[model samples]
Target chain A: MTTSDTSVLAPLADVDPADLARLHAGLEAAADRAGQLDIAYTTFDSPVGPLLLAATETGLLRVAYEIEGHDRVLETISARISPRILRAPKRLEGAMRELDEYFAGRRTTFDVPLDLGLSAGFRQLVQRQLAHIAYGHTQSYGQVAAAVGNPKAVRAVGTACARNPLPVVLPCHRVLKADGSLGGYAGGPATKAILLELESAA
Target chain B: MKTGKPPFEGVVAEHSATVLRVCRAVLGVDEADDAWSETFLAAMRAYPDLPADANLQAWLVTIAHRKAIDVTRARQRRALPVENVPEVATTVPAPGDQDDELWHALKALPDKQRHAVAYHHLGGLAYNEVAEILGGTTDAARRAAADGMKALRTSLMGSKGATR
Candidate 1:
């Protein structure tokens, strides 16, 4: 569209600033009173089977699979945060772009920033080790534990992978069991299997 | 009003189109989705403390606008080496015969003016409303929108004049 058409829309302008100010103030008041916000929703047809993504200003806090009772999950998030939640596919910009590139075989590594605040120290260490796992390569949990400077932390590394905050970005899927088993993924073993397969195919 | 309900659900349901329009105006269709999502997420986090009497639509618009700007800035930051970054092909479909070319022209405008026009015109917001959302005064909003509209008109007319 050209600028001329936009000029014609000038006649439609008439919103009140006071109304905007009032709205902003009201929302702030509600959030403050509520403590945290409950913002959880899912979009479909994602390469990874109806992906679930959630976040706050502090950073991404959760990503899950599409199970039943999604509303209950949303309520849980709201209870932890506030009830001022909304759902829109657009908010997953960085994640979506990286996922798209990964699926398209154009990207082997994700450069997106992550907020692993919710993760514990050991989990963070495991995540860091997982990040170093080369594309199209898999490492046993023992190997990851060794990489994290805790040779006996293999079991801890497995648990840490289960608790990883940023999954796809950190490549926790790359960590297999000591016997080369697929191990576990919070998103599901099948999802992990598919991701590894995709990397191998690429 | 009773508390405990989702604070901005009403406002979101009411003004979602406006928020989406602002996002579309700023980031174009491809990236508007993410900007819109971030805006709502930010709103959700900020909603409880929002003043009771504020204009919800404008508040959402302001947030959406900021999110759009952030998305663009982030994209610019992540721009790869020239060889790695593929050329952006123009995929915007052609306008229909009855379609107004003014919005198309407006999209060609600089980011600030484009935002000004979207907030004031497409959003059906007053100059003061635009200003508040943009962190400026009524006069500034008016000036930006006016300048944007003027540019759009001139450009459109020039194109038409050439065609004639």
Candidate 2:
């Protein structure tokens, strides 16, 4: 809707672009001061594609692939977590750096803390086990299921990896299909292959 | 409660401009940004508790109304000394700024009329909702907005004709 309700006020309806920017920055700072910003996120270009990284005070919350739709991912975060989210890159600085290093083949492991609040129960259990798969190591879904102490829950393990909130950081891409073929990835098969290839080369 | 609230960031992105317009209309530019920031900060704080299906714009305008009053109260508390008062007691926005003539005309309207116009017309609230926010009957809010618009046109036309 137009800012002006009447023709007379329409002329004055234009909010100065500079003022809007300045005011938003001020709001972000104020929200942070008030402890109202629940999530801070940033997007960085990666070898596979752009990745959306989000964090809470606890630690890194999510890592979304470009194919997953950044806006949709943020909306899901808002729904599941708190909606007081902002695109504050500073909160994700460490995670972003580690990701860059990993993609560049200079790093093998992530040291950043993970929130792991998005997944729960068996899914959370499976996600937690994924990190131990190591940087360049691969595990079949059946293998991962058994590792989590549920040999018959192979399909469930696949679901957990597919729904992984922190994919690359948690190393869900390392979980492959039973036949050693690429399994379904939250970041899509092509991205899964890219991550796997990047790791295998290193 | 509908149980699904979108991100507060979306709320800010969608409605910040309108809220700023309402604030600028109510408090002028110098204080509008402050009011806008305060309103969103407050909104973000209270967002989780808000009903998922509530009318967001009207809710935000209501908050902006409160914040604007706070600003006005602060301004009054910081009143200048008699000798320090300017010859023209108007808040004239910078020259060559967007909508200078219109802002001057808007600045001339009475407080109730200005708020009625801003909340209903600029903020896109219904007259009844504006009435609820303004604490008056719906008809009164409608009349106030109509009068405010008329005054704006008269003042703007007079100034425009004089300049031409």
**Winner by DockQ:** 2
Query: Model 2: what is its DockQ?
Result: 0.58
Candidate 1: residue B53 lDDT (0-100): 72
Query: What interface RMSD does each of the candidate structures achieve?
Result: 8.9, 2.7
- Model 2: how far is A165 from its true place, Å? 1.0
TM-score of 2: 0.89
TM value for model 1: 0.46
Best by TM-score: 2
DockQ metric for all predictions: 0.13, 0.58
The best candidate by lDDT is 2
Task: Encode model 2's per-residue lDDT on A50-80: one tens digit a residue.
Answer: 9999999889999998988999998888888
Q: Tens digits of per-residue lDDT for model 2 on B1-164?
A: 12557877788878989999999999877788889988998998999999877999999999999999999998877775444677245655677665665667777799999999899888989999999999889999989998898788777775567321
Clashing residue pairs, backbone N/CA/C < 3 A, model 2:
none
* Per-residue lDDT of candidate 1, residues B1-164 (tens digit): 23344334556667756776666666665676677667766877677777767677778888887888899888877765444643334444366522224445656787678888888776777788888777777888788887887786676676667321
